[model samples]
Structure formats: C-alpha cells, structure tokens
Target: MKRIIISGCNGKMGKKISSCIRERNDCTVVAGIDKNPESFDGFPVFAAPAECPVQADVLIDFSHPSALASLLAYCVDKKLPAVIATTGLSNEQIEQIKECSKQVPLFFSFNMSLGVNLLAQLAKKAAAVLGDQFDIEIIEKHHNQKIDAPSGTALMLADAVSSVLKEEPQYVYDRHAVRKKRSKNEIGIHAVRGGTIVGEHEILFAGHDEMLTLSHTAMSKEIFATGSINAAIFLCGKSAGLYDMGDIV
Candidate 1:
C-alpha cells in the first residue's frame, strides 16, 4: 500500500481527495498539513509542514500558492514524491517547483482532469492541422469561488496550441477597451466564473466558411481528485524528476 500525506487537508479539493481516497485500499492518507490545523477525521493536521512528523510515500498538495515554499522544502528535505494541484502560482514559484523536482519526484499540472489535458492535446493538433487558416479562441468557465481568472488550464491550452504555430501568437485576454479588429495571429482567451459550474473549457478553430469546436466539461470534482490520486500512485518508487499528467495519461 502507498502512504500519502495531504497538504491543505481542510480545503475543498483537499477534503474531496481525502474522501475519495477512503474508498480505495491501495493507498492511505497518513497525515495532513493545513493552515487551519483542525483535526480531520482521525488524521493529524499540522499548522505547517515543519510540525508534521508522519512519513509517507508521497505528498499531494491542493493548497494555496502561499503554502508552496514550506511544502516544497519539506518534500525536498525528505525526498518525498509530490503531486501539486494548486493553481494561481506565479512564474517564480513555478521555477521553484521545477528546482525542487531535481531532488524528488514532482508532478504539477494546471488542471488534474484527464479530459482537460486531452482537450489541450486536441487543441494542439487542431492548431497544427488548420495552420494559419483558422482563428483560434478559448473559453473557460469555473465556479466563482475560484480565485484565478482565465484559469491556468486556459493558458496551458493556449501554450499547447502556440507550440505548433510557426510564430508565437499573441494572447488576448480582453478586447473591450481596444476597439480594434481581431488579429489572426492572436489567440483570444475568455474566462467565465459563476455559480458552481465545476469547470468547462472550449477551443474554437474558426476558418473560412467553417467552425470547429472542441470542448471538455467537468461534471464533478471527483475526476480531479481521482486523477491526483492516480498520479500519486504513479509517482511512488519513481526517480527524482518533474512529471505531469502526460507522464501517466
């Protein structure tokens, strides 16, 4: 059985993962670290990573971006494999995570849903085949409680499409202020946040006299939790390196 430590055990995704893991027998959550440090079920919750004494096969983080530094420190110090699901991280923090991966197995992704990653892959392919003939646009929706706009998954999809393009395409987040015509070389990304819409992403490839749209809609959060758990299991016994959904999917 794989032993796991859950960072941000009290948060929404944290609690969701904890609940899902309970249904499985191959892995168990040994301990948790959370800012609230409230007792969750029978496991101990630490106010910070330094206070957690329980050792595990891997750590899964779905906490705030602010908790990244300490969590990574603990993981690197103990050479623990980690699956990071937190979003809204800055560029510097991403670099930090990559650096820590050199010492321990680390998995990070903008979105944990396998469908979303698959959508990203499809968008890249569509962009490559359509070439300069299509005008690309991305639309993503999430629950309003989410703090980030445009969603990290949106950027990941855009980046995937840009990778196959001949030139770096301009990313346009908003066009309300500028009353200019849409440029063919730019990819428009729009974010919608409201109610409890789980998550949704749609990529549009608009060409002359034709429109091609690919989308992925998340019906529930369980998909992400399950994906994270699977990633944790995959990381166990793996060598120190950076891994993403692609590694397992």
Candidate 2:
C-alpha cells in the first residue's frame, strides 16, 4: 500500500480527500498537517509537517496558498512526491513550485476535476476552429468561502483559448472598470460567489449571430478529491518532474 501524508487535513478538500482515501484499499493516510491539527479522523494530525513522525511515500496538499512554503520545504526535505491541488497561488509561488519540481516529483493542477480539464481541452479546440471572429467570455461560480476570485480554473480555461489564438488574447477580469467597447482580441472572465455551490464554469464563444457555450458543473467536492488521490498514486514512483492532469488523463 502507498503511504500518504495529507497537508491541510482540517480543511474541506482535505477532509474530502481523506474520505476518498478510506474508500480505497491501495493507499493509507499515515499522517496529516494542519494549522488546527485536531484529530477529527483516526489518522494523526500535526500542526506542522516537521512535527509529524510518520513516513509517507507521497504527499497531497489541499491547503491555503499561505501554507505552501512550509509544505514544499517538508516535501523536499523528505523527498516525497507531492500533489498540490490548492488554487490562487501567486506567480512567485508558482515559480517556486517549478523550481522545487526539479528536486522531487510534483503534480499540480488548477482544477483536479477530470471533466474540467477536459473542458479546457474542448475550449482550446473551439477557439482554434472559431478563430478571431468569435468573442470569448468565461463565467465561473464558487462558494462564498473560496478566497480567490475568478477561480483558477477560469484562468486555466482562458489560457487554453489564448494559447491557440493568432493574437494573444488579453484577459479582461472586469468590464465595468473600463468605459469602452469590448476588444476583439480580449477574453472576458467573470466570477460569481454565493451559498455553497460546489463549482461551475461556462465558456461562451459568441459570433455575429450565434453563441456557442461550453460549461462544466461540479455538484460535489468528491470529483476533485478523487482526482487528487489518483494523482498521488500516479506520482508515487515517478522521477523528479512537474506533472499535471494532462499527464494523468
């Protein structure tokens, strides 16, 4: 069995991942790290990674971005492969993750849902086929407790479309701030937060008289949790490198 350590063991995604692990017989959670570190589950939870005595084959992090530095250090020091599912990381932190991947296996993804990543692929193909004539807009919805605006998956979808366009599309987060007509080469991304909505992303491609929309809705957190668990399993024996959902799917 693959022994795993969970970072942010007290968070929503963390707990969901724990549940996913329990449902499987091929892996076990040896320890968990969280700021609150209360033992809600049978596994031992420590306030910090350094304090955890359990040895693990891989690490799965679903924590806040603020905890990234310490988690990375722990993983690197222990030579543990990591599956990072946290969103809203800054550019510098992302660069740090890339740098650390050189020393240990790292799996990172904007959205852990397989369907969402597939949506990104479809969006890219639609953008390539539609060309510059169509206007692109992305709308994303999440729970109010989500700290980041314009969920990372929104940006991922935008990147997918921008990668194939003739002119690199400009990301427009807000149109109200600018008093001007929408540019032909701009991709608009809007965010909605309310209630306990799991997640929703819609990509709209609007042409002169018609609109084509591609959307994905996440009804539960289990999709991401299951994906992360799979990622951890996939990373177990891999060489040092940066990996994503594309590698798994």
By lDDT, the best candidate is 2
Encode model 2's per-residue lDDT on 167-225: one tens digit a residue.
98889998999899998989999999999999999999999999999999999999999
Instruction: Kindly report which residue pairs in candidate 1 clash with one another.
Output: none
The local lDDT score (0 to 100) that residue 191 gets in candidate 1 is 97
The whole-model C-alpha lDDT of candidate 1 against the native structure comes to: 0.92
By summed lDDT, which 10 consecutive residues of candidate 1 come out lowest?
Answer: 35-44
- Model 1: per-residue Cα lDDT at residue 2: 94
Q: Compute each candidate's TM-score over C-alphas.
A: 0.98, 0.98
lDDT of 2 at 240: 98
